[model samples]
Target: MEDWKKLYENPPETGVLFYNETVMDHFRRPRNVGEIPDADGVALVGDPRCGDHIKLYIKVKDDRITELRYKVFGCAAAIATTSILSELAIGRRIEEALEITDDEVIKAAGGIPSGKAHCSLLGVVGLHYAISDYLRKKGEATSGDKR
Candidate 1:
């Protein structure tokens, strides 16, 4: 596999070859890159196939996402996606945050490589899981719990 060897030897500097400037920026200095103690909602999700994992924390107040934080264990795209997702979710209603889509996250990060698009989807799914956990703790039916 000479081609594979060459590719590995010349890997992209930012870890993702086609990552735009925004993605590189976020990957280098991710926003909300931590855990929130006493968070209102917390979720941990992973893609076993790709070995990517994301942990999202949210603080909700009066049905609004007052704060957000995240930890990502993956490539540059994963970090950037979660970073942008945090920004989009904060200061918005929980329902609005839930509406944040993978495409929106990718676009906000200036677009990730097509091969890394799943990372953005992971960010969205992580948020959904966190929101569902919060609603459950509040004794409310989550979207999936509804008949």
Candidate 2:
């Protein structure tokens, strides 16, 4: 296992493992960290297993996401992941945005800790939910929706 993982598994009683500079940058100055009042679609997703939740909002124009925003209530990883998701989704076509994966988000964020990888998955899931909501509102087929 990685040293960070070992440290996390057997944490010292008096210290905390700080997130890397990239993660800290995102967490401290998260982009698109709000709601879009005139959003074309909005989705709220939660990980019952981890008790983390995210609300994603999107504005679509000509089948492209013109704007993206998110509100996250979770750990630094969750917040950073969602922030990165918004950056990745904005200006992309709905299908293209849907193609975004957890791995991409993790890579864009300079890699999240293995134990917190689920947070990146949640970010992608949140974006998918938002796109699904947009399709549903437009009366389009949502058969491609993956959860």
Candidate 3:
């Protein structure tokens, strides 16, 4: 509760005009909400208790992620986190995309509400899992595989 309270007291910048606008705009108009029919890989995760579910799709070429998309179902925080993550992953090298962390996503969203901080982790986990799926399909064990 303390962390959530702190967020309420000092909301972070969400790259929007209004502080809350960041979360609202993202949730309302989430990016990459559909599927890519030819996606190389896909990852899905869900928190049944919170009813937070996210699916990420990625397309890779020459060890770089050329495309990324997502379909997320959850609270405002989770949806916004997914939106930001998809945008960041596109056109990134696979390794670079894998390096993206929950902290980075949260910070980019002007800091999610303290109560919703965990939602950011959901997005990170989804991304990692999605990348793992892509790597596995490409016959690699982990993102660290140099070959």
User: Which model is ahead, 1 or 3, in terms of TM-score?
Assistant: 1
| lDDT by residue for model 3 (20-49), tens | 677778888988788888888888998877
Question: Model 1 misses residue 123 by how many Å?
Answer: 0.9
Q: Return model 1's CA RMSD, one decimal.
A: 5.5
Per-residue error for 93 in candidate 3, Å, reads 0.6
Stretches of candidate 3 off by over 4 Å are 1-19, 140-147
- How would you encode candidate 2's per-residue C-alpha lDDT over 44-83 as one tens digit per residue? 9999999999999999999999999899999999999888
What TM-score does candidate 1 reach?
0.83
Tell me the tens digit of each residue's lDDT in model 1 across 93-132: 9889888999899878876777888999999999999999
Give per-model TM-scores: 0.83, 0.82, 0.79
- Which 10-residue window of candidate 2 scores lowest in summed lDDT? 11-20
**Candidate 2: clashing pairs of residues:** none
Cα-based RMSD of the predictions, in order? 5.5, 6.7, 6.5
* Regions of candidate 2 where Cα sits further than 4 Å from its true position: 1-18, 140-147
Clashes of each: 0, 0, 1
